[model samples]
Target: MDWTALWLSMRLAAWTVAILLPISVLMGRFLAYRQFRAKGMVEALVMLPLVLPPTVFGFYLLVAFGRNSPVGDLWQGLFGHQLVFSFEGLVVASVIFNLPFAVQPAQRGFEAIPVEVREAASCCGMSPLASLWKVELPLAWPGLMTAMVLTFAHTLGEFGIVLMVGGSIPGETKTIAISIYDKVQGFDDRSAGIMSAVLVAISLFTIALTYWLSARMGRRLS
Candidate 1:
């Protein structure tokens, strides 16, 4: 396996996690607590990526961020470059592709906390934001961590969107999944196996970490 692709994939996953963490946390909290008009519709929209085809997401992203569209041109004007065919593009695609992975778990975590706890905090005159930061977030820390790890892992495994938006730019956008695909296409079975093994090891380690953390959190909460 080319160490470069492994490194690139790791970098991409790390960046994706860093970018998605706060956004997902806020979204998860909103979905859990906010009862607004079309709340169900908002939840459905958030879950859409899970059911949407990866290629279709990639295709739309390409058009939306490509050099021609209004948003794309506006971005180009501000950034002096296009979003498509770049690492930045892959980051955007990964965020969109793996959004639900981060949101759903975090939302569930927030939901798991009793409403009475929030009510007690409110009774004590704590602002909503303060209650969230001091009460809800700590209780949901394990779930947040799980969401982050899972989202990172899922993005690392993404292929179609990365290929479409980033164009397999080796050393920049050629993540592990794309590299494995290329190796297999070129009949380089050995390299493909090596990459696959690495990915599997990482995924297994993550799953174990999540379970352990969840159990620990359960004990602590109890």
Candidate 2:
């Protein structure tokens, strides 16, 4: 068992979830409430990753984050290091790759809120921000949990994007999925099986727990 790789995957998933939570909430709320031009286009763009091939998406990200690109150059100049093959790079890639998993559920949750409830919140003198923090969030808690779990699990299993962006740098960018691949390629079937089993168990538990909790919460609410 590669403890370093296991820890790194956990850290990456945790960081991705942390960064995405507030962003998902804001974007979800905006999409839920706003009627704007190209709304369908905007949604399609947000959802593109879900349908796009991971390697193809990763190839573009590789070019965009390579040393020659403006954003890449700026980051290197300021931070004194390139972003590629780094843990930070993995986090960024994971966040982008798993964004829809976090945002779509949250958006649906927000949309599920009744118009009457929002109107009542306004009538009770709650500002939009206040209502979001108090009323909207409470009602949408289950969806938010689903978003976080999905993102975490998705990040845990990422291979293509993380590999393209971060490469396999142990203790830095090598995640469990990559580690499993490496082990298998090296004919280390026992190690690969162990890691693969761990991933499967974790994913199964998270998905099962998420649905169970959602069902329990629904029953309570009803």
Candidate 3:
């Protein structure tokens, strides 16, 4: 197995979760509590990545972040390097691509909060921020945890977008998934098999843990 690549994938997953967690919380809480125009449209946009093919999404991202594009140019000016084919580019792509996974569960969790509970929080003179931290987050822990796990797992497994945006540069952007592809292309079945098995094990563990948390914490909340 490519240890370096495996490490890179973990790093990428960590960065994605760290970046996406708060965004998911804020957006998910808003969508859960607020009603406004084009709400369905906004929710649909968030869910778009779930159905969109990875390669297609990656292609659009490639163009959007390419050297000639405004985003790319601005990033280049600010960072002194092209955005595409870099590790930072991969993290940005992973966060965007994993939006639904992180947001949907969080939204559900926030929505599950009882109106009376919130009213009571306000009655007790808790600020919105304090209510979010002390009341809402504890109640919504399971969903938030699920979102974080899903984002981390998806980032580890993501292939097409990672490849398109951040090409296989070892120790930089060559994540484990890309490393597995490289191993296979090079006819190194043994290494590929090892890497695939590792991923499968991690995925199973995360998924099962998600279900467990949802069940156990969900029951306590009830």
TM-score of each: 0.94, 0.96, 0.95
lDDT of 2 by residue, 1-222 (tens): 898999999999999999999989988888988899988998898899999999999998889989999878988998999988889888888888888999999999999999899989999999988998889998888878889999999999988889889989999999999999999999999999998999899899989999999899899789
Q: Quick one: best TM-score, which candidate?
A: 2
189, model 3: CA deviation in Å? 0.7
lDDT of each: 0.87, 0.91, 0.93
Residue pair clashes in candidate 1: none
Candidate 2: stretches off by over 4 Å: none
Positional deviation of residue 217's Cα in model 3 after best superposition, in angstroms: 2.7
Give me the runs in candidate 1 sitting further than 4 Å from their true place: none
- Cα lDDT tens digits, model 3, 27-77, are 999999999998999999999999999999999999999999999999999
- Quantify how close model 2 is to the true structure by its C-alpha RMSD in Å: 1.2
Clashing pairs in 3: none
Task: Please list the Cα RMSD from the true structure of every candidate, rounded to 1 decimal place.
Answer: 1.4, 1.2, 1.4
